[model samples]
Target chain A: MKPESAVVSITVNGTPHRLEADTRRTLVDLLREDLGLTGTKIGCGQGTCGACTVHVDGVRVLACLLLAVTVEGGQVLTIEGLGTPDGGLHELQQAFIDRDALQCGFCTPGQIMSGLGCIGEGRANTAEEIRESMSGNLCRCAAYPGIVAAIADVAEGQGA
Target chain B: MRPFEYARPSDLAQALAAAGPDTVFIAGGTTVVDLMRLDVLAPRRLVGLGDVAELRRTELDGDPVRLGAGVTMAEAAALPLVRERYPALAAAIDLAASAQIRNVATLGGNLLQKTRCPYFRDASSPCGRRRPGDACSALTGHLEQRAVLGASPHCVAPYPGDMAVALVALEASVEAATAAKVVTVQVADLFREPGDAPHKETVLGDGDIITAVLLPAPRGTSAFVKLRDRASFAFAAASAAVSLELDHDRVVAARIALGGVATRPWRSSEAESAVSGERLTPERAFAAGEAAFEAVARTHENRRGIALGARAVTAALLACRGG
Candidate 1:
């Protein structure tokens, strides 16, 4: 059977786009391949690796596990949308830079995205809490201590 | 993944009307999309249940707590009522997957999630659970995580879920909708042993949609302990959930369930009976754990898992004492 297509009007980072999406294509594919949002990297096609984490309707979720059509009419926020309006880096991104949280930088976008979710969910209160909450996003470079410190620095209201 | 049509139903009736043998109801899409990507499962239609408002409702004040099928694991875990009254369920959800997954994974989907058995997941491998005529690959490959209880000659892949184990111990029931009417099935009876028909996992009929999970009034304090290869983002090697009530140090009531050590969400009646009447001491809890796995048909590969399961049971039961 030919893969069915559905017209999906999704708002990404406050910008709306209407496209006919394949039912089989994941949200990550739609975001990167279709919308040109290359910041949302696909690490593990499965849900295990949180490299494709994004916010749908203000809730963080794994984009790889969701069909592009399933998120129609929903508001999505990816790594591209997380920056400040004046092209300034988001506080979490600045915190990662300040704390030297990233090594290979492959998982940084996801870590920052999930870190924002962690902070939004009030899970970045402490070091342990941040680690537990950020466990979803894997850093193969093993830059965990800095990652936790970065989240903690932001959660502690130290971000500048 | 194979090409399939998608439909988003706004209500239960519409969702039910769209159901068929070739159709699948997608809630979280965590398990469904993963398996579909592997070409392990291909359905003609995918019915999106995300817009069904009725399925997202949660009734906590009632005698039997009604948690809607669409309630995400993170949403369920964040509820103060659930965290305070049913800590075991909260812990089970908290310890599962990760925050990103919990935000999307619904309670109903969590219970119906597939096993983590590599052989069963790899479509290239011959798995009886995935294809009936195909031989069980886990039998000859890696049995380290296979079932130590409720296993059959055909398959021994353990059920890799923590929520169902906690639900079974708490005496929860699943409300499902069929073409005829809504029916309730005990959480313990929802899963089936991998017997001759290793392909069939649940008792629900084709096109049956789970509506909600009903939990009876809070029985007592409960706890969930999971033994895994790592702390987070990994399936349990062996885990236990225990609920206990004490009358001045003497045990009044007790319930126990095991996960990652069986083919189904295992409710250990023997463990409950062992700790029921007696004061729950450390030694007594250990004995209860021993009784929990006494009937298990242990083998060289799964013996360690059985031992870990026993210890997990003891740990969970002991944790419930101070709660």
Candidate 2:
């Protein structure tokens, strides 16, 4: 169904974009559909799953739960912005790869996006804290051990 | 997400006026937006309170701090005043949803969040709250883990979120603005009992907008505890928010409220009086918790309600004592 209202201007990964989207359209759908930035996925859709996670105004938010109109004039960052095309992943992404933190690859993008904010915000000070913070995003494969390792690896390397 | 007309009002007055026949006031849109997508709210008008600046402020009003309804859980949790003076409220927000959801979920939205009854979320299910004529599937099927307190003839649903208990414990109040006038109501009396009207949650009329949540200064050491199947992700099976004002080693004042086990946020002066004059002790805390829940009528399958609620209340009291 077409959304009856809302015209929003969003800066996705530093690129200015405009769309006359509906209130029903979520930030994740806007990114993936209108802008074709499908890097952000949708899982639980109820904000329980981190699959649709993104950073809005320098903070992490579940895009699945955020209305497109609510984010007008805000800066949004997704996993697609964290690294270069030269295979040089962000430090968190590199740590995830080094630690084999993913299995099915379905939750990797969300995990990476959340991890970026976790490390960037300096909240991943301890493994326990990372585990506690990451509880919202579920890994059906239960790949927690590897995920923790990836986060801890970054914190440890940072001398945290 | 079902298609709907969206309006982003720049101010509170505009937003309140915009709320009408099928309009919902959305702040953060962390919970209400999802429900709209589920078609749970087929409101033709989606009024965005996001741009309403006055509704996003946090300031002191007399002895209490007035937090605008639009303040997100994450922002509220990170506030210095919230962390210092309202640890229980802060913890409740910190423990809710996730960092991601908290970043977008507002305090007013948290209180206004619908029940987490799986039946209610499933539109096809026979839930009285969703469909007037539908039978309460939860009343007969999978009655375990349903409401243990304040169950009504129309529904046996449990309020899922954790912030309500904390707010109730702190004696928080709300400023509700309607198309006609704005009124202040206590958090303790905000919810309307689901006697015959299962759909009515708050007393606010069709065009009312929740302007702000005014939280009184916590009287004592405050703590909020939730007992859930999972440490996170899951809603509370039982929860309690306890505030204790100690006269050195003796209890001077106490406020207690419970969640998950009640249809609405349950506050018990009866429970607080049980330990009002006693010295801080585990036995006293236990006594207060039991007294507060003495009126609780737990069913067979969810007998754990009393136990979990008691444990949460006692734990909060103990936290007050720093024990």
Candidate 3:
């Protein structure tokens, strides 16, 4: 049987959008393909990679694992919602730039999104806590030291 | 992934009514969506349990702490009452998955997570758990992460959740709602060993929606220790959950549950009996650990799990003493 599509009305980065989405479409695909918000990358296409990390109702979630229709009326936030180069950068983003937290930049968006969540949850108080909390977002380029430093810098109020 | 119809029911009755033979209930979708993407599971209908508000509550100020199935792992771990009363459960849930996953994955979904056996994940490989008639590749193939205890010749896949192991040690019970009535079953009775039917993992009936898990009030000091390949974001290689009551520095009661080396969340009555009336000395803890794995069957690649599991039990018991 052919699966039916449903209309989902969601608020993304303070902007409301209503779109006809396939029931099988994942949130990551909906963001990248349907909405053209390609900042959320699909690395493992599973929950392990964390490359598709985003925020739904202020909670960090794996976009690849969440169905688009399940998040109806949810407020979604992606890396693009954090800040832009022209509009200025979020504190965490600036910290990432200052700490040199990116080598390939493929995992930066996920790292930033997950880092925002870690800080929002108040779990970035120490280096061990930062590393343990950020373990889901794997950086294949081995940029963990700088990533931790960046998160700590913002969490500890050393950087903006 | 194959296309499927989705339904978000607002109440337990509607949720149970939406479920059918070809339907699967999705809470966090951490495991279900991953398997579906791998083509390991393809259900024609998906019933979303997110809209059921009653399933997301947590009540801890009573004799039996009731944790709603929809309560996320992070929420459960961070609850002050849970941390004070059931430290083993808090540790188990905290050490599982990652921060992002803990924020989204629910307790019910965590209980029902599938194995991490490579053969089971890889569709090309023969896995009895994935297909009942298929061959068991882990029996002769790479068996490092396979089960060492409660394993049958049909399947060697291990249950990969840390929460269930702690629940078994804490003597928790799950409240499940069906179309007919609600039933409460012990966490220990929830799993079925892979004796002949490796495919039948749990005893959950058709249309049974797990509503909540009831944890008895804390009886003793408890701790959970997991030995894994990595510090975090990895499943346990060997783990132990221990709860002990002490009187004048002597063990009055003990409960032990093991993980990462069993077909299911293994409660070791032998280990508990070993230290029931004895002082919890280092030697006695080691003896209890040995007793836990006395009857364990090990393969060529999984022999290390026996010793590692023993050490985990000893370490967990010692940790209960603040050692």
**Candidate maximizing TM-score:** 1
Stretches of model 1 off by over 4 angstroms after superposition: A1-3, A158-160
Q: Model 1: per-residue lDDT, tens digit, B1-323?
A: 88899989888999989988778889899999999999888988999999999888789898799999999999999999999999999999999999999999999999999888898888899998888878888888876787888888889899999999999989999999888899999999999999988789999986888999998987878999999998788999999999888887788999899999999999999898998989989999999998988876666787788799999999998899873
Candidate 1's residue-wise lDDT over A55-135, tens digit each? 999988999999988888999999989777889999889989999999899988888889989998988877888889988
DockQ values for all predictions? 0.82, 0.74, 0.78
True contacts kept of each: 0.92, 0.92, 0.82
Q: Local error of candidate 2 at B74, Å? A: 0.5
| Clashing residue pairs in candidate 3 (N, C-alpha, C atoms within 3 angstroms) | none
Give me the displacement of residue A108 in model 2, in angstroms: 1.0
TM-score per candidate: 0.97, 0.95, 0.97
Q: Distance from true position, residue B25, model 3, in Å?
A: 0.9
Docking class of 1: high
DockQ of 1: 0.82
Q: Encode model 2's per-residue lDDT on A15-114: one tens digit a residue.
A: 9998788666788989999999998989988777798888999988888888888889999999888888686778888888888998897888899888
Full ranking by lDDT: 1, 3, 2
Q: Looking at candidate 1, what is the lDDT of residue A33?
A: 96
Clashes of each: 0, 0, 0
Clashing pairs in 1: none
The list of candidate 2 runs beyond 4 A from truth reads A1-5, A85-87, A158-160, B60-62, B132-134
* lDDT of candidate model 1 versus the reference: 0.90
All candidates in order of DockQ, best leading: 1, 3, 2
